[model samples]
Target chain A: MKQARDSAPAERALFYTPESVAIDYERDLGDPGSYPHTRGTRPPNTRRETEGHDFLVRELSGEGPPSRSNEQFHYLLEHGATGLDVIGDTPTQCFMDPDHPYAQHAVGNQGVSICRGSDFVALYEGIPLDRVSCDHSLPGGFAAAGLFLAAETHGHLPELLRGSAILPPLFAEDTGYSSNLPIELHMRLATDSIEFCSERMPKFHAFVEDTYYISDGSVGIVDEMALGFVELREVVRRLVARGLDVDLFAPRIALLVNCRMDFFAEIAKIRASRRIYARMMRDEFGAKDPRSLAINVAAHTSGATMTSRQIGNNIARGAIQSVALYLAGVRAMEISAFDEAIRTPSREAHIVGLGTQHVVQLESGIADVSDPLGGSWYVESLTDEIETKITDRIAEIEALGDVVELAENGYFRAIFTEAMVDRSREVVDGTRPVVGVNINEIPPERDTLLRDLLENRIAPCYDRIEEIAAWRASRDMGPVVTALDNLERLCRDGSNIMPGIVEAMRSEASMGESIGVLRECYGRPYDPMGCVERPR
Target chain B: MTPTTRLRVLITVLGLDQHEAGALAVSRLLRDGGAEVIYAGRFQLPETIATTAIDEDVDVVGISAHSWEVLHYAEELALRLGQADPPIPIVVGGSVITAADQVEILSKGIDATVLPTAPEEEIIATFYRLAEARRPRL
Candidate 1:
């Protein structure tokens, strides 16, 4: 009933008949696996039919020490998870060692501590890298280097590795993640990793742009898809200019989309994003390969949609979003735990999220038919409308001169803030029904267990300071210094920083050190304790 | 506008915690409640925040902490603001903080600790209460 901010408000359509909307099956609703893939990417009635083979059930699992995360990985695997969405701790994401002054408090608090190549080795000690698809949230190519070094040490070839890097251009800059370096340097490092992956780890999806961090419920669903396309275009244009084939990277450019509680809108957004991406690749990028035309989507159940008032309601939200993604033919899916609004998901909450996906896939026969809502006139109309709105927004961004210039000038921030303020006001004023917040009012109760979890066991990795110190002391510093020197040199030479970072990782240089070398090369001050300043 | 309408509140994130949602929400609530709200945005050092508070001549400062670094940053902000003739009231909130953290933050002379999920009315009430309490001292 509600509309996204940018899109036209919900039309007062009492009934939808065939006369209301006309759809040309060939042009608008083409068959799956064909050009301008509107219905689905893969063919209908195949692995996607009845059997849930097409979609990888990825658990967004990780927390505390690498060993603890290792346990989570195994736990998910044991529970029939197809892929592992490895979440790096705040320190790791920020490229800080556990011993760094800023990192001492946050290590393993948000996710798993991954400051060194050894951490990756420990994270996947028994898990075969080649067999399982592992997605990481680490930016600035730190995870790529760490994984490379770990693979080499564990006698696994880089070519056989498969995974995705959540290296969105401004993930750290946009989100409050600690980005020690500026955005330009971060982009360079990310591109370097992508370039390396293109040549070496061909199966690995080098970039996953998650607009959720910036989405923040501020913009419409179409705005989210449009912004993602704008970013994809920018990145692909840069990569194409750098002499890389579009087909090489386009297939691996996965989108991590947030499926909020808007059921039909969320479903439409997913379908629209796929069609738009396909056409953009084929028409603009000259992508001849069908694989390049297709898009891999990892739908994450919206964390912003979860409420602290009625925590259990989040389970229903997660299930609904998962079903939407499944029906939309998303390649990978992650459901946020019910307790995420309060703290890092507890073990029970994590299991519930994983179980939600499993139940939706097995019990709900919705995925048995390809594009279950394909022939529905309402869905088809919504899909067309969403695609048009998103394309218009992308064009709007392009009209604003250089995308980089716009990014630097607080354009996106302004857009996000205005929309967010408007959304929040609507929620407060009862215009937007946010379930527990504005409607279905529940008298608040002091959940002591929730408080206890927050006060005590929420952040499960506090004793890592000593272990990190010990790790630092045991590792030889000479080779680490040498590797850093090489990294700095490579960075200064405007060369790909991947090789040097992998070499540094091999020498046991912590993630922070590798990033520090790049920071130095970029002529930026090295402040591991410093936070990235918000755009003015 | 009356003095109450002119009352200023600065919302900021402390330490390396980059979560801006809490700070932004608080800023919006305080502004909508008729107080002038100055958002310090993210990744601000304690000194920067304290100096900004002094420079802006704000009535109160709210720090959104979403990591363990809040413990470190809140204490640092207090120490910086304490040097002033009239130290500003600082409120901390986020999912990462706890009752123990609230106690520690208050012990450092922060004015209040509002949970992120606290009602908007409660948030607005806290702002006015702290602003009024600090008026005489200022």
Candidate 2:
């Protein structure tokens, strides 16, 4: 670790001595890719030169069947997008068959509707697995399978295979999906997933702790929404102690926290998050591996921060989030388009969004220097101070009985409600200007069709699944049930449920049975007794 | 002479994934409506619907479903009510039936398809109207 300038103030502050500025860089600033891993986490000098071209934004889930997602992937890649983010159909996430009664609701909400291993093979099709990073980020029924296949296809199964696939947490608390499932069951399933990955896909990460959620059914917020990443640390700790080897899992367990409008705060979040995670993993859990402490941001340009009112104002919002990304040490970004609130991303919007990142990477000369905010007294001080705040916050959650209990009680949800109210009041009262919602006298309506088209397009997948249902009825049910039976046995004994699940998947067991096995293990649904008095 | 108006609400659990989060979130919406909600949990049967609505004598029976296959149970529940000496007004919600699907559901005597992940206020307001429209028929 080298120090250029630690005592000088590049920027002055009004609120408090720039907290990020106060960091003891002499003590913490490590090399770009080393342990204590403060400066940067990825391989040294891996920052790609910002492309002059942009990702050709294309709508997923219509016209072409999802089995052919790679066509769309290649098209977008050829056109502009540097990476791919997949949205699988309902059956896969819920662990049901396309024909299952549970999946008939929303088959292909946004991305491709994945079914089994065959669907996964087709989804990736020709996309090179090792070249560009793919974010089939969220994990559910078939998510891990998608990753395993991708890893294997590349023929690079290094003994310790690790990467990110967004995974299920004990949902239903707020995703509006997991609310009905028993929290314990969901927790157990998540735990089982972590256990499974630790043994085989050692180089791969199992959980994303994504807080993007079905939030506001509207806009997005920062990492605070991600099950309180601070508290989620305990989830990792508990799993580590369960004999799965904490040090090995630490390198793989990364967070995909959100970056909202509070720019400096977002910066502090990234810097402070590193220190917080490092100390927690090292101090609390006694984790020796340094990578486990890294905080990776699956940076989504704020959805809530965007304005449908002005329509064009969202571009500015996207830029603000993009700059925040650089300051925040963002690992990967899913920059939102200009009209995100009006509708989904259009070609112009996506290009503009990706272009924003390109501009940052190329013109700003920010990535050339590691830890660009390394010596800012404000950034450093805030890094250390916020490290305390976030750590204390996480400790508060742990006091309530780890991740499962705290989530069941809506601890973070309650805090979020209060924060939203405070933030919303500022927007409404003119203390803060939204440019579209409260500030603009007349809100724009250019993209109502986009919303309607999305609503309208999702209908047919429901009707099509009827055929799958009939076909599934005749596939031998014995293997499906038996695989699930093994899953139950393994889960009850605290053995990793992944192998059993993989076996079931091989046997062509429907996703529903996978979830059923999980529910059986965790016990059928539990309803919380107290109402957390917060939220709109 | 006085006239009373009822609220019409369409609530459903959207998507083929039987996430009970909708059931509870919908329940909050229903409770806010001040109407006796015919609460149906995951994996509901046709009879569960008929019996609960009959027992509660509610103004609106809001059903939650995550998939289309199961929404038929909701429709059958609605149909069972309609085939009776008098039919009850049924509204839908969840990812199961979007606004586009609302028309198909309405053809079966359903009043609405509650949009997926509607907030409590919107869900409640929709029900207030749905209950009013169905009250006369019931």
Candidate 3:
């Protein structure tokens, strides 16, 4: 009975043993802050002294218009939040202004909506661009240029601005739906940002591969690892082909992967990711900088795993995921609030989410030892297994020619569709029982807790007609037209479009106007009101 | 009744919420369960969602959400569908909506509400029940 119970097989392996896994300490596990860095990218507790802090507790935030987000940012900063992760709304991300018909209902619904550089200035008002690090979660492209223009508006030097502009995959949503712009156009914008950041903003990360989006597509952990690396490699290839060295920008790029409820598997996934990145940067890409070898990882707690049945239990889920992120030695992390399953997290929920991190950091002592489980037989063995799986998956993707081509053709999308269906079936069929959902099922009376929570939720506020009227009436038309013409010329010539974008932003050109210039240059139809019909 | 006739279901997202995992999963599940599925994609307005349902002649419209936007948009969608020439059955599902909220949305003309963890049988039954109920009007 003991043997049967102990030998139960996991998803990858049938059984576990040091000899069976063939673990060699020198070859497989290296010291902390050393090559391979399986133990961690740094020794335990050194990050606090060297970086003046451990991981930055940056909460993913933003909603309503720029002024609203600015106030929210101040509130968060006043409440112990160390950094900013601005979430741009759909219209801002798709390069549409609030005035667009398609954007009317969506403005300020998910995140802060901005139409030009001035919106960004207002969004970060009074927050010193030079002092505080920020991350802008912009979906489309050219957000880096937008941020640069915003900083410049405040008389901040381009070189002194810090933080990142996360280039979400070319596609807006992760459901394999059609993107606002085609793949090539998205690449052009991304490459433009990379080149501009490499030259002007040395401290800024022009792009970060967000595997959180990959996981949102319902792909498994191994697939997330494989696709994230492929994305970074593709970006590097594009940059290097443009005559930029690998080390010049690779150090600035980072990875923001998902942290699922699978504690040990998630730990192994993150650990293996670092090792793989180190090897690829050093050997394949011929990177010399040690900073380039060290992959900066940020983890977003899994929203998919949150149970709506008993939402209160989600705090425990977040705590478990936070531990996984911290144990894996992530540079930054965000925990989804318990109420995330029911609505936009309330202020109390945000406090609780941040408090959970504090508990793990202060009381739990989980962050005291870097990669505390690094040498454990099980963790080490699982790390090796996950690394092999990730490499194998990438090899399969490489056989399909360029990853971008494959992605455009729906190769990765098909995988996620299938994985999502299968996982849902497992849950529905009770083969994989979620605690508060499938088992221990209990429906609260009247659902007063959730109802009260909903009462506290504020609907996003935006008046498109009025706001657009005021904005258009204020900006000087001559400079806007000249800047847009210059942008079109740069786009037509295939020159880096970042400088032109910054110029256009400086002239108070709205996002739609900037995108319109590019569309005209490409001879593509300009319709901010257009929707990409979901292809069957 | 035609022997090969299949129930056509339309799944979509509304407002600014971009969570597609639940929507995509439901699409696949319904597809595998022998229903023809049409995904309208995410960030669509309530008007667009209603127009698509009418254009596609879908038997049931399923809206997915992951934020409070769903509460407002789903209600609007439900009202729109109710006002259609031949009102279509509407089902709203997601992780964030509570039972009381579901009741409120249902009262606003949504035909059914499915939780993220709802079983396949319950989902299928709700769709068929609502679709069948709307057949006489059609």
Candidate 4:
């Protein structure tokens, strides 16, 4: 039989790897402390603080609605996690308070439920405000809606307090976000957030999640990802022109990313981002402050791959993801736990998650050298190739029109469908090994870890859920009602919703009410403006 | 017959879940073995899924999940299908679904719980096995 041709090189799949992507493993170009930022994001200083737990520890939410996610907050602090990344429940992140009807089903699925000053204060009970570094992945829902919810809790946005508040408006609208507000109107509010954050909070990172490039079902070319950054760069320049100190805000503008476990592909993404952002910051935006040019990033493990079967397998997966992100040159990082695929990570799961980082950061010696793979022939070549692919995809999207147009046209949807089709085939075949999932025949070892949560009959965090639910029920309804009305007015009138959300929170509005108001204001999901076609 | 008039088959993976690779491959194998596929993207809810299958009038449903919580959910979903007098064939796949989960699943009235390591040919063979097991018995 004649041999068939190998199709990898032709499809440009060769560049999507770790061996080709992870560079410079052998040489020590610089110590961990070097300024050019190669030997890990920081220097090799064995600060005792970074030793005991994760170099960066984020707290899980707490037991009360009016209560804060303080249980884990205090734990992270007492346990020596220097920086804290706290997640607000969906209600708060969406600028809603707990009592809103929209929030009934989603109170504490992801994190803590914070509605007002008291909740924020309580959440931060033991943790000092100034010392903790927080990343609030709140989207404004087509307007700068969730910013204030974060502000009341964190004492002020970090970027703004540090004189670098550059809150970029949410642009990747394909995450099922279709607002009743006009695109131009949304643009105004986003820029408003940039302006507001620039002046008020120091060290704040007004940003957009970058997982779309690597994760979202929308699989655009590498160019589309780069172009998204480019468009964002333009948004920054537009702000600079409007007299927001471009240097301060733009520099503090960080990229929220998901480091997919495709190890080298992720490494290449970071290098591309830095090189791309550096050029954009220095040359395009003319950002002179070293802070402005610095490309800071916060990464999560790919949510897509976080699975439910053989839950313990996610630990190794999370570790691989962390190693990938750190390799990609992120200064600070957070890791999801092995149990992440199951539900909100248990306290023990969170600790092991933090421990995973410690193992990688301290024990594995990964952070001992700078972009260790930077100079490698395979890595550099792949990095360049990834940049090319990303750039091409961005242009393709642009040619089709802006992100909104691509979204409206389902261009993004089509790409993801195709990607899914391809991946589903891999799973059906034996091409990819998911360990205990697919290839490995063994069951979890007896002490695989988390004896109680893994082996025993621990109940679902249902008690935690019920606690927040009851708190929402007990709160005064009058003020929350009024807050929702004001927020609705803001949403309807094309006004920036961030301030209104904060105002509502101050009134003890629960997250649900706040989010409900906006959902009503934005109306239901999406009404295809031009499809007009009859249903099948 | 209207192209949509035929019974539909929904194959999806839900939650912070994404691992279309194996399922994608399995989907093609099933297609070759003669099954219509309604491939919903990741993070589909149970209600949404049930509604899709009902609306599509699918005779067989195959769902994939990666995380432990989702696998447990998948099992519950599969078990629930038997209650629908005209039961739909349910098959589950993903990295997490294992030989043990498969056995527990069979007892729940699920036809099959496909392992990620199984060959495509085995998936086809199993697909037919389940289909035969589910043959109309008026």
List all candidate RMSDs to the true structure. Answer: 3.8, 8.1, 4.4, 7.3
For all candidates, state DockQ relative to the true structure.
0.43, 0.20, 0.48, 0.23
Model 3 misplaced stretches (Cα beyond 4 Å): A1-9, A12-17, A20-27, A43-53, A170-179, A446-451, A519-523, A528-536, B1-5, B15-17, B43-52, B67-85, B115-118, B136-138
Put down candidate 1 lDDT per residue, A146-200, tens digits, no spaces: 7777787788999989888887674346643657566678678778888989888
Error of model 1, residue A276, in angstroms: 0.9
Per candidate, native contacts kept equal 0.34, 0.30, 0.53, 0.21
- Local distance difference test, each candidate: 0.76, 0.56, 0.75, 0.55
**Candidate 1 TM-score, C-alpha based:** 0.92
Candidate 4 lDDT, tens digit per residue, B13-127? 6533434545565566667666777777554555566777667656677776644445445555765665555666787766555556677667766677766555667766665
**Candidates, ranked, lDDT:** 1, 3, 2, 4
Candidate 4 Cα deviation (angstroms), residue A20: 14
TM-score of each: 0.92, 0.74, 0.90, 0.72
Candidate 4 local Cα displacement, residue A204, angstroms: 1.4
Worst 10 residues of 4 chain B by lDDT: B1-10
Better of 2 and 4 by DockQ: 4
lDDT of 2 by residue, A1-536 (tens): 00111111223355455433534444576665555556656544544555322221222222124554667677667765666776555445544455544445556543456655545656666766655556654335346655665456556462434345665464444553443456666666567666667766665557666655533332223235324464366567668667667776777666665666767667766766566566667877788666666655556656656654455666677777777777666667777666554343455555677677767766877656667776666666655555555555555555667566666787655554444444544554676666646554442234342344333233437544764656566678777667767877887887767777677667666555565556655655211212111110
Candidate order by DockQ, highest to lowest? 3, 1, 4, 2
Q: Taking candidate 2, what TM-score does its chain B reach relative to the real chain B?
A: 0.69
Q: Compared to the true structure, candidate 2 yields what TM-score? A: 0.74
TM-score, structure 4 vs. true: 0.72
The worst-scoring run of ten residues by lDDT in candidate 2 chain A lies at: A527-536
